[model samples]
Target: MFARDTDDFSPSERERIVKTAVSPRPVAWVGTRDAAGTDNLAPFSSYTYVGADEPSVLFTASRRDGDLKDTPRNAIDTEVFSVSVATADVLETVDHTAADPGPEEGDEFDLAGVERAECDRIDAPYVADAPIAMECTLHDRQEIHGRTMLIGDVVRFHVADEATRDGQVDSREITTIGRLGGPYYTHTDPVEFERRY
Candidate 1:
């Protein structure tokens, strides 16, 4: 095992270590509606799983980079957003959305050629092709280490029929893509292993 204190490393070095150590983070292809009602879409790998026992919730962290990224700002303004699961089929489009354009630039949906559909409960839109999507209302917002932590309460879930079975999701069926270090990505093909009880 190897580890180093973050204080001893430069920001870029720390980022590299963090991104690599986090191992295959699920990519959130999030969508939100701007003040002008235009649909904005982007992908973030800094997402975490919120437990099922509690209220249905998911966490996504975004930077307050001068309100340039539409997702965070729009969620703050409208109190709503959508989180869509990214898969290998849409990986290219997802990558395209991660590109940092100017604040005044048009929505990434147009640039990525991804179709968007209205979220049932929220004013924003969601990716039509995502195997699963959650319409979320803002639960809380806080600043953590210069990033905005947007905790959303899941209002509605849109899951593809093929991915759902016996009232649960089949991970193998969904085949979600995950982000790795640099430009690497991984698919959710399960590997069975016995857990020590």
Candidate 2:
């Protein structure tokens, strides 16, 4: 057995340890609108549903050198966002959203070759390919200890007909993707995970 205090490691090193340790994290294909009203989409594995009782979701964004990225920046301005589930059917294109030529390049949705569907309750849009989508308005955020956590109130829900059976989501009908340790990802089926950075 081997163990060491993580406090001795650098931020990147700590992240590596933590990320690898947490297996099968849910991914959210987040959508936001920029200051120019241009649509922006990105996939984040660091996300989770706070609850639907009050209907909310929380996702994290990283900042460097005091600069906020497209997602968080637009989220701060518009105070709204959309979350589209990254299912197996559109997982490839969902990963494509991670590409970074630059924010000024163009809309990631168009770049990734996905259709944008209007959200019902929020000011944002969602990936049309998603089986389930949530329109959310920014509820609150916690900015502390060099981390920014974005929390949203889910105001509306969208369910593709095929994804639901008898008013309940049928998982067998829609295989969703999940993020594993590194560059590795997993589908609904069991697989021997590979390391990715």
Candidate 3:
């Protein structure tokens, strides 16, 4: 095996290396509304749930061409956002929203032509067809290494009937998509195993 120090690579190369090594990452389809009430939708794979019980998640938004992206800017200004699970069925739509459309170009929801619904608890929108969507209130925002990391406390969850069983969500029932290195994506097809203590 051959490896070089992180400093050996340029920023873009370093990002590619890290993304390649991370295997499959869950995509967070985040939604927010600008102060002008323009809805913004974007996908961020640099996301994960950081808390339980009260339930919270965090996603890092990076500058596009050295400029702050609209999602984080809206979340920061409005203090609210929504997250919709990116499923395999909507992979193309999810990827479409990744493009940076200027606020003047038009909101991504209309650009991508994906159906959206209003979040009950927040002044934001979510993918109407997604298996799971959560409304969250901004809990904190921090700038690190030129990236904006925003944490949100989940206020409400909208789980599709088909995605839930008994009283909880069954991952097996949802065919979610995962982001791979470069331009690759994977779908969840569970390989069950019994764990023995």
TM-score of each: 0.88, 0.89, 0.93
Candidate 3 has a TM-score of 0.93
| Tens-place lDDT digits, model 2, residues 56-117 | 99998888688887898888889999999998767788888987646566689888888999
Find the candidate with the highest TM-score and give its number. 3
Task: Show pairs that collide, candidate 3.
Answer: none
Tens digit of per-residue lDDT, candidate 1, span 1-197 = 86777798998888877889897988888899878887788888888756565545555555554453567888889999899999888788899997756657767887778888899888999999788999988888887777777878888999988788797888878888887887789988888877999
| Tens-place lDDT digits, model 3, residues 1-197 | 87889898998898888898886889999999988889989999988998989899999988888988889989999999999999998898899998877767788998899889999988999999899999999999999999999999999999999998897899999998888888899999988988897
- Candidate 2: C-alpha RMSD after superposition: 5.4
Candidate 3: residue 168 Cα off by (Å): 2.6
**1 or 2, greater by lDDT:** 2
| Top lDDT model | 3
Candidate 1 accuracy as TM-score:
0.88
Q: Distance (Å) between predicted and true CA of 9, model 1?
A: 1.0
Local accuracy by lDDT, each model: 0.82, 0.85, 0.92
Positional deviation of 7 in candidate 2, in angstroms?
A: 2.1
